[model samples]
Target: MVHPNTTPAQLSSILRKCAAASVLGSGKQAHRHALVSGLIPHSTLETDLLLMYARCGRLLIARQVFDRMPHRPLHSWNILLSSYAQSSLFHHSLALLHPLLASGLRPDHFTLPSLLKASAGLDHGRTGAALHALAVEMALNVHLIVSGCIVDMYLKCGWLVDARKMFEEMPEKDGVVWNAMVTGFTKAGLLAEAFNLFQKSQFEAGDADWMALPSVLSACSQSGDLRKGKEVHGRAIRCLVLESDAVLSNSLIDMYSKCGFLDASLHLFSRMRVRNLVTWSILISGYGMHGRGKEALRLYEEMRREGLEPNSVLFTSVLSSCSHSGLIDEGRAAFVSINRVYGLEPSVEHYACMVDLLGRHGRFVEALEFIGRMEMEPAGSIWGALLGACAVHQNVEVGEIAARKLFELEPGNPSNCVALCSIYERAGNWDGVAEMRRKMRDLVAVKTPGCSWIEVNGERLCFYQGDVSSPSSKLMLQALRGLLG
Candidate 1:
C-alpha cells in the first residue's frame, strides 16, 4: 500500500532519524520501504543509507549499500571512508583510498583528514607523507584543515622535523594550529621552542587567548621556569582569561610546586574558588613530592571531609608520601585498606610504592612477599625497587634473584645492569661484577649519560656529560669545587 512516488528527500529524512537515534535496525525497513515504494535511490539517498548503516554498527550492510550505489559521489566516498576509519578498520580505510583516486576523485580537505587520521592511528608516517604529497600536488596543503592534519600526522609519527616544517609552512594559523605546535613541543621536551611559540601567541592572540597557555604552563613546570610561569600567570590574571577554567588554575599550581615553591602552590590551592578533582590531586601530589608526607595526608583527610571521592590517583599520592617519609605503619595500613576504605583497587603504582617503602626500610623479604601476592605480574618498577633495596642492604640472594628478573624484564635498561653490578660489588663478588660489565659491553647497553636543567630569567639551560668545553663551565667547576670544600 506504499506510494509509488517516494522522493529521495523523504527517504533521507527517515534515514537521518534512524542514524541519529542509533536505531539502524529500522534502516532495513526504511530500505525496504524505498524499494517497494518504487523509489530509485539517488546518490544522496544511498549515501544516507550507507551512513545510517555504518552509524548503527551494521558495517556489512553499509558495504552492501555502498557496492549497490550506481553512482558514488565524492562526498559519499568520503563518508564511507570515514565510516571505516571510525570503526578502526584502518587497513580497509587505507585500501579504499587508492580506489578513490582511481575513480578520478580528487581528495578534498575532508578526505585527507580522515585518511591522515587513519595513518596516525596506524603510526605510518610514510603513508602520511605520501598523503601530504598528494595534498601538495592538489595545492590543498595550505588549507588550514589539511595543514593541521599534516602537522598532527607528522607529530604522531614522532617525526618532529617534518612536523615543525609543516607547522612553519602554514600560511594562516589559528588557535588550534598554535596549540598543536606548543603542545607537541612541550611533550617532546623542547621547552625553549614551546616557550617561543607561547610568546608569539601572546603578541598574535594576546593574553586573552588561553588556548596555548596550558601547554606553555606545562612546559614551564617541567622545565622549572617558575619565573616565566609567574609572568604568564600575571598576564592571564590581567586578561581575566577564563578564570573559571579549573585546568589553567591546576596547571598554575603544578608549575609553582615544580619550581620548588610549595608555599606558593599551597596558597594558590587555598585561594581557588572552584576546585575539581585535578586541583586536589595536584595539590596533594605536590606536597607529597616535597617530602611533606604528613601535610599530604592531612590534605587527603581534608579532601575527604569536603565530600570528594578518593580515586586511584589520590591513593597513589598518599602511598608515595608514606614511602618518601618512611611511615611504615601508615603506609602498610593504607596499602591494605585501599580497596576496603576507598572502594578503589590498588594499581601497579600503588604496589610499586609499597615495595619501595618496605625495601627502603630494610624489609626485602616482606617486599618480595608483597610482590608475590599481587594479582597481576609485578612490573619493572616493583623489581627495580626490590633490587635497589638489595643494593642498599647487600642481600646477595634476593639481589641476584631480583637482578635476574630485572634483566629479563628490561633487557635494554643499562641502569638495571649497573644496579646489579653495584649489588655484586657490595657483596665483594668481583667476578660477578666483572661478568656483569662484560655482558653489558656485549649488549652495548651503556649507561645513559647524566644531564641536568636549570632555569634562569625565563630561559631553560641544559648541562650534559662531556659538554663542559664552554668558558662558563670552568667557572661552574670552580664554584662546585668551592662548595665541595
Candidate 2:
C-alpha cells in the first residue's frame, strides 16, 4: 500500500492531512510509504512524517523515526516534543528536553507549548513554574497562543493561583486564551466561575467561537442547566459550529442527555452528518447513563457493523451499559471480547464494570472470585461497587468485608459508612447501625454537604443541603406544605 512513486511534497501533503484529521491508520500507512520511497531524511518531509505519527498517537514509531534522523533541526525536536506531549508520555517527553537544548537548537514558540504540555500532563508544579519563568524570560509568553499554554500549564499543575495570576497579567486575551481558562475552570469544578466568565466574555467579545461552547456546554451539563444549554445550542447553530465539528456535536449530545432531554440528544445524533468513534461513544454513554442498556448494546453492534473498531473506551461504555441494565450475560460477553477479540487488556475500569455487572445480579461470591482472578489490583471502585451491591441486597457479611477494604483505601470517605449503615438497617441489625455511626464519629469523618444548582432567567441559582437562609425559604416551605396538603 506504500505509494512509492509519490513525491516527497505530495507525501507531505498526505501526512499533514492525516495529522489534522487524526486518521491514525492512514497516517501509519503514509509513514510506511515515506519509508519505502527511500526518502532519506534529515529533511522537512521526514519531520512532517514524524509529526504525523506523533499526532496520530503512534509514539513508539515517532521515536523510532526521531532516532533515525541523522541531523535533526530545531523543528524536528519540537515535533518530537509535541508527539510525546500529545501521547501523554510526559516523563519520556521531559527526558528529551535537555538533550534537545544540548544540541544547540534554540527553543521557539512551538517548543514552549510542548514542554508546557508535558509539565501539565505530569502535574509537575515546580517544573511548570520554571517553564513559565523561562517563557517570560525568553519572551515566548508574548506570543498570545503560548500565553494560553502557560495558563493551561499552571492549571494542570493544580496551581490555580499561579494560573489566575498569569491570566490576569497577560497583556493580551484572545479567544484561545479565554477558552483555555474556561476549560480549566470547568475542570476544576468552578462551573459558576466558568459560566460567569463565559457570559462576560460573550458580552465583550461580540460573538462566541466553537471552542467556547464545549466548556460552557459542559458547565451547563454538569450544573443541569437545560436553559443555558439551549442558549449555547442556538449559538452553535448561528455560528454554523455544529455543521463540521464532530466533537462539539458530541458534547451537545452529552449536554442534552445529562439535562434529561433524551429526545433532543437522539435527534441531534440522528442528524449528525459524520459520526466518528467519539460520537458513537458519547451516544452510547448517554444511553447507558439513562439506564437504556439494551439500546446502548444495540448501538454498539451497529457501530461494529459499520466497520469501526471498538477501542477500550467504547468497550467500557458497552460494559457499563450492560451493568446498568442488569444484562449480566451480555456484560460478561463484552468483557471477554475486550481481551479475546480486541486484544486490548482490560483496564481497571473494565474490570470494575464486570464486577458491578456480577454484583448487581446478586452474584457476590462470583464477583469476589473474579476480583481475585484479576491481573491488576482491585481498586477502590471495584470494592465500592461490591459494597453498593451489598447494601442493595442487604448482604451484611459481604458488605462488612467490602467496607473494611474500602475504609483502608478511602479512609476519610463517609459514603462507605453510609452504605454500611444502610445495609445494617436493611438487615435488621440496629446495633450494627449504631456501631457504624459511632465509628464514623470516632474517625471524625465529616461528610461534605451536597449542593445543587438550577438555571432560571439565564442565571445559576445555587442551593445547599440544609440551607434555609435564602430569601425564598418561607415561600419554599409554604409551597412544600401546600403540595403535601
TM-score of each: 0.90, 0.75
lDDT of 1 by residue, 163-250 (tens): 9888888887777878888888898888888888888887776543577888899998987777789987986787675367788889
Highest lDDT scorer: 2
Residue 231 in model 1: shift from native, Å?
Answer: 2.2
Candidate 1 error regions (>4 Å): 1-6, 17-29, 38-40, 53-64, 84-89, 206-209, 342-344, 392-394, 456-461, 464-468, 472-474
Tell me the spans in candidate 2 whose CA falls farther than 4 Å from its real position.
1-115, 130-140, 203-208, 339-344, 369-376, 425-431, 441-443, 462-465
